[model samples]
Target: MNKFRDKLSTRNTAETGVRYEWYALQRCAATYYREFEKPKIIWGNLATRASFTYDEKDHFFINAPACMLPTSSKFILGVLNSNLISYFLKSICAERQGGFIEQKPVYISQVPIKKPTLSEEEKIIKLVNKILLLNKRINEIGDKKTSESARIEQEINKNDEQIDEIVYNLYGLNKKEIAIIKDSLMK
Candidate 1:
């Protein structure tokens, strides 16, 4: 890989022929993550809503237009996917047409995270894991129109609501702030 590294951007490689051994990736992130697997949160860079997802596989080669959170914490996933975080991101992130917000890392990083106690964090992780399992089952079921899929989705929604409540309480948000969070999502 070292021999081919300099050749990549040089005129020599263009003439001699390309070596497929080189990792086709960004200059910095490529070399480091090649040998390691760490859980990361992947979220759509441009989406109609907050869609922060936990990267269970821990494969670092996520494609373009997604923001990466450099942590494996399911508790963080629970907080990120909550309505409160979604509302927070939407308020600050740049909005494009079609209601999609530009969830650039610069903006995503600004979303505050309030650390909960170990037990509370564990509770959130459990809920997040439940949602992950439900999501997995839905994927296994494949067809979205099936009763099984619907049931799993309903459970996921319930889990999401629970996470949101937990996050709201953790942040000590007022009813008025909660109302604003809820209302901003409406339109």
Candidate 2:
């Protein structure tokens, strides 16, 4: 065990550009949240659906599911928020009376991800960024312009649909599989 510990690499991480030893005392603590770069994805420990979002803050998470994914890309955000992954997670997570699902780190680790090519990743990031901007604009507009807010929401919806399509293509899911996922979501 000592030999293995000695062999552990102490290096910088691409995700945050922060260096740390494999067995750092801080990382081994009960909180389990490690140092992550800003603009990283964060989601609740429990959710009825895939509810992941990006935050530009350095935080010590409390009451949050812990997962160490070295993702600092908006493409990852797009994939997580897509209907495909949502459907996959909903099917696997334990359900409660009010449709609450226990989206613990254990199940999250089991998610099947197809690493995108450079071009594909860029495309997804572009679309996801557009959706993010539209959402921000909606929030900024507030109730001042209900019509403008509605228009921005429609734009967001369109981008979300595009994202789902892109995700489906990424996984090579056929018509039947897509239909099944769509049906499950409607239920």
Candidate 3:
């Protein structure tokens, strides 16, 4: 994602470029919200509740959850807004479009922030890392289960083949007879 971010800043603005910017903005908004907001909300909610505007030819957006006000938590709101500005200044400035710009402000809900101390931030970071690690372990276990199931299926198939060979030998059936019997069983 960092590599993509690097590429995004250097790329030319076309249709794909616009799409990339849209995606990057969405991700940046979500990240900023999560990093600053309390009890992190869903990305869909953030996207739906927030919007962008062109400020003096500069594209900017306020990302907030519904039913919140920027005035409600001015400090956190300022932080989030600043983060958005920095992300754009650093990443999205190169993708700015030409004409057809509007100066109206895009009203999105204000993000709510729980003013956490440094210790709280550290705790949150540790918790988030633990959750991520657990999720990764769960994914690995799921993959291993899938692989084991496939291995068992293959073993069963081999056992069936051995059983069929034993039955053919017991019945004194020739290769052609065994083939006919196998075809009939398949049908």
Per-model root-mean-square deviation over C-alphas: 5.5, 7.6, 25.9
| lDDT for each candidate structure | 0.80, 0.78, 0.37
Tens digits of per-residue lDDT for model 2 on 2-77?
A: 5667555543255445556776545333232444644567778677788877766665564456444446778988
Question: What's the candidate order when arranged by decreasing lDDT?
Answer: 1, 2, 3
In candidate 3, what residue range of length 10 has the lowest lDDT sum? Answer: 48-57
Clashes of 3: 1
lDDT string for model 1 (76-114, tens) is 888888889888888899989998889998998898889
Give the top-scoring candidate (lDDT).
1
Task: Give the total clashing residue pairs for model 1.
Answer: 0
Model 1 per-residue lDDT at 118:
87
For model 1, the stretches where C-alpha displacement exceeds 4 angstroms are 1-26, 60-63
The full ranking of all candidates by TM-score, starting with the best, is 1, 2, 3
Clashes of each: 0, 0, 1
The candidate scoring highest on TM-score is 1
